[model samples]
Target chain A: MTAPSAVGISRTTRPLAPPRRTRRGSRLRYTLTVLAFLLPSALPLLAFTIYPMIGAFWTSLHSWNLIGVMEWVGLENYTTLLTDDATRRVFANTLYYVVGYLPLVYIGGLALALALNSLIPARNLLRGIYFLPVVTSWIVVALVWRWLLNPSVGVVNAMLGGLGIDGPGWWTDPYWAMPSIILASAWKDLGFVMIILLAGLQAIPTDVQEAAMIDGAGRFRRLLNITLPLLSPSTFFVVVISLINGFQVFDQVYAMTGGGPAGSSTVVVQQIYDLTFRYSSAGEASALSWLLFLLVLAVTVIQLIGQRRWVTYA
Target chain B: MPERIRRILLTAVVALGALVMFFPFAWTVSTSLSPGVGLDATPQLIPDDPTLAAYRELFANTPFARVIANSLGLAITTTALQLTTSSLAGYAFSRLAFPGRGLVFGLYLATMMIPIQVLIVPLFVQMRSLGLVDTYLGVLLPGVASAFGVFLLRQAMNSVPRELDEAATIDGAGHFRIFARLVLPLVGPALASLAVFAFMSSWNGFLWPLIILRSEHLQTLPLALAGLQGQYTTQWDVMMAGSVVSVLPMLALYLFAQKYVIQGVAGTGLK
Candidate 1:
């Protein structure tokens, strides 16, 4: 950010520089060199991201069981998946997880950011401790939480017992299974959200808050009027990222519950996995993925537009 | 209400929250060390009689050693490939002014928004067609290029002084020589950050490896650990041991390069 503008200023001021486009031989050499630099990455990205994206859509229109040749059954997969009761339930489950996850994570993240931003001893160590989960793999985290939330002999229930209350059967109970996953997910992401929000917090000018303080603004009022408004862009960033990730919550659910206890915690990506690998319904899986993509794109676009109303840029 | 009193209160609150974050990890280590067949009815922050029995069983009873080797090998390869590809492309985008550069770069960035789930089925098919399924190549091929890494490095490379490149050009150094000798050294920190991110993501990757790697001998640490959790449903000690082993490398990496990891994550969000 600092370099490009400085270079622009220097270019305008210094007039004796040689023009870049004049030499035919050098231009050809430059083009070849750029191609050489680009092709290594460009090839894999094309084969994986670009080609498979188009191929995913094309496969969604056909029926294949991964062993046989793809049979053309255009739109049938989409039509069936769209109307299936199980599909609706799984999509609804994903939404439920996102609804619970997004707010919990953001609020927790913001709270942590605010506390860490204040005058505190060992702030750096505290920040690293909170971020520990973010660096750990989802499988490990889910496994640990599964043990932690085990209904029979888990620490959480024991802690509750000490408090004279009974802890619910977390991942084991069908009713509480999704909530259990939400808790684990939110716990893992709090540090990520904290780091982003802390960066935003530090970016806010101190003079603004001091100015408010001189004007007799209390702590809460300054937080509302001066701080949060300046922090909106980071807040928007965390929300959009958390929302996109929430829609694709799989590893934890897979490891924790396996969408279990009557498929209560079954999510969209898990459904995609089940449809493709378990059921051998590759076409439906591809169709379901497309549906997920559309949902993410729609939600992200809406958030982008909505940010204009609430997100303050300074 | 007093300044010192308020500071103490704030410190206490933050410390409590930090404990909540760190407790799971502390318990995992404690449980792994505890000598028992399964979990106790009550939680124990410290085991009464700790032993290395679980870790011993984790290695003896399972293919954990092989799993770690597989994960380490794949992550190292993935990180190396990502650094080469992303740095080369990033330098080109930042320095060389080619036709349709903006459009191509924009396409790369757009691809970043599409989650990997969308490409899984077709990518599996493509790999199977190439006769590479259940092989290491299949697991590593799709992830060799990263759009996020490219963007991060481009931002880093963009900040390098152009006047240095101009002087190098005047001295008749070609683009490759200048890229190798001049620009790359200046962007070492960004490259380190990219390396860290690439290694961590590959180390933690589950879905692709689950689908592609089928053999017991070829599974990554996460895949094997999940398999262990399923195969030994009641063995909490063993499971915790596996979790600890899988997490230790990442813990070490984060501690060793703490700045790059945090900076890389924060840099992406802020930008």
Candidate 2:
């Protein structure tokens, strides 16, 4: 009985020991290697992302300013922001911007990318021209667009006048300011979307298009049936990036309008900035920022969900 | 006849689009060189009297050269740092089998979604605590190890063959040696693209520097240009000159690296 039991134990133990030992060692090495690789970014993320996020949250629950005594205010800041008319209008303006600006940018980018995809002379130059606005600083672009849209002296209105049409006061007028900002922002973001879409277009295998052509499909038919479906992955990418960017639209508005002309162009980010930096209302600003964060997260989640139905990775 | 008409129509449309796209830059240049008050009148394609007065004023009244130098310095240094840090991490992510690697990378990607504006207050606080405010290092440090850069380079590195690494290893090379001798040379184009991207982003950065920098001497070109616009009213020529100064370096870089730049943009989906 002892000999039989010992033989069974030895047979079982020999097979298991090597794999278990190797697994433990490999896991340990992998953990160390990953940590080593991540150290640089991890440190900053902790300092800048995690710590600040936590600090901002804590600050949002208090009434504190630079060089002032801190006082805990509970949820008063949140409640006040919810009821305030000015704050409400800022949120509305941001929503209006998101609704108005995203379509122009996305559609314009897609059209341009498609058009550019066809063999054209000076395609490189054309791509450069389209992308120029993107590399230019927002401050400079804002200033230049402002100059170009100046009611009396601007070239844009001058061109309209050449056609015997009137152009609105783009920046000064309350009614036209948000639209003007949107136009400028769209121009800036157009190149970005074009690049993404172009990448998508390039990734679509030529065989599919050839097959469609062999099947007697016209160019439009091919694009509608094959290219568009295949390009959905990139399109989905553009949609997600654009939506996230649209929510964080700040620089152009800040530089050009400053949420002026009866606060028509006021966006939530601008309001958060003003509250925290300008007015020293850290608590309220933090609340507003968190709200903005939640909105962005929700939109991102929606896009992710939609992507399953629409996006074709290959 | 119909085909000719279609070709002509397409050409005309494209030409018109190009002109519209380029008109603003042309106008800015024309206005910058215009002699006097004429620029403030109805904008024109050609300046009535092209003069260098604005350029003279731009250099005279402001630290225009210094501001440009500061921008170049920050951009170059940041790009260099980003390339080194991101490439190492990218290599590790691509080749090394590390525990929690997927979880760590996912966390890194998640940081990309966090709106930068949310970080401003806390970043400012942290920088102030470290006494880094008003310094170039402060502006450059936080951005050196970009998650996007790491992700991008890692994606690029994945395309490189494993045989090369194995060959180098068999030749008595260590991990770092194999990386330096074998991997670095193969991914040169990708690295170049990343460098250009990193440079442009750093050069055009506004809000972060605007918040951190207070001293006039230390201000970047955008901040300086904004200040110039605010200080002088109706000095369109001078302002335009400042704008040209700010844009010229970028234009020069773009013209020189047109091929690589386009390839980079097309490959990376960078704006």
Quick one: best TM-score, which candidate? 1
| Candidate 1 residue-wise lDDT, B1-271, digit = tens | 6989988998999899899889999999998888574544654788888889989999998999999999999999999999999999998888775546789999999989889988899999999999999999999999999999999999999999889988998898888998999999999889999998999999999999999999999999999989988777888888999999999999999999888888888887788
Estimate the Cα RMSD of every predicted model relative to the unseen true structure: 3.7, 5.7
- Residue-level lDDT of model 2, residues B93-208, one tens digit each, is 77765335579889888888787687777678779889999999889877877888888888888888877776765676655676677887888877877887888888888888
TM-score of chain A for candidate 1?
A: 0.92
lDDT of each: 0.90, 0.79
Runs of candidate 2 exceeding 4 Å displacement: A1-37, A214-219, B1-5, B38-40, B269-271
10 residues in a row with least lDDT, candidate 1 chain A: A1-10
Q: What is the TM-score of chain B alone in each candidate?
A: 0.97, 0.95
* Candidate 2: share of reference interface contacts reproduced: 0.45
